[model samples]
Target: MPDTSRTQLKQILATRYAYLVRRLERITGSKEGATDALHETWLRLDKANVSTQVANADAYILGMASNVAIDQHRHERRHAHDDDVDVLLGVPDELADPERILTARRKIDSLKDVLRGLTPRRRAILLAARVDGQLNREIAERFGISLRLVESELSAAMKYCLQRMQEAGDPYTDSRSSGPRKF
Candidate 1:
């Protein structure tokens, strides 16, 4: 009985090979992948024991092909080919150069110096607004000051840092006639 069913499926597959391939191509998006999936489907049908009859052989065959294609895609993703490794190796390193790293470190140190130079209350206000991510109203309430005072302190602190950074030749400073640093 199973042999009879397998034979019937094989006959249907052979008769509708082109139609099945077209449908599979639409599902897999690649002609070669679709063809391979169909071939795998054929091999599976040979091995499979169909105890019950399939009501719609065409749809069953297409579903089997789709499953095979999905399995192939997952297997390919899990096992990287040599070309993939070579491509990864060919990619340029994106890390900053030593000069850029040094400049960044210097900028950080300059910022720290500027922050240290501020009055303790101003420094605390700047840290609360910037580092602590507190709202202006929240900061004002916490410090027992008016919202206007909080805003004024934050603005002054920012302006002072900008002036100090410009004096220290910060590449990012707009004060330079050459414009902000490219990097």
Candidate 2:
């Protein structure tokens, strides 16, 4: 309400504004983000009824700027995804933490060793049964084999493949059963 108080606020803001902007820029590493952060800081300070409590106003502004930048960085980190070609080598997009990604990659590579030893026919049949969700009768009919042969072949193939995969140190192991269980 007083002219003198309004003049004092204006002077303090003008002197600290550039410093706030620069600190924000360093935190965000972008001019646009820094400008937005500065605007948000000014808005927050203006809305609060406690600006008079600020003894060292510049330090207070810088503190706000730092907190805003850290929050923004954390938000970005949460949504950041891997776009590298290495993702083609088999990385789990669900796991964003670097150690988890690296462990998933190692597991994939280890499984590949087992996949290399698998017969193409068995691999195709397994993929069709497991991934394509085909019935054993359907897979037998599609592959032109008897149902008995489908069961026998899948069992033998899975036994060999699972043994190899487990020995290769794959963290994710595929389960095997001798015959279908009625539950």
Top model number, lDDT: 1
Per-residue error (Å), model 2, residue 72: 43
Q: Which stretches of model 1 miss by more than 4 angstroms?
A: 81-83, 89-183
lDDT (10s digit) by residue, model 1, range 52-126? 988899998999899999999999888988998999999987777898799889899999999999999999999
Model 2 clashes, total count: 0
Q: Candidate 2: give its CA RMSD in angstroms.
A: 17.9
Using alpha carbons, what is the TM-score of model 2? 0.42
The runs of at least 3 residues in candidate 2 whose Cα sits more than 4 Å from the true structure, single-residue gaps closed, are 1-95, 171-183
TM-score of each: 0.47, 0.42
Q: Pick the candidate with the highest TM-score.
A: 1
How large is the C-alpha RMSD of every model relative to the true structure?
14.1, 17.9
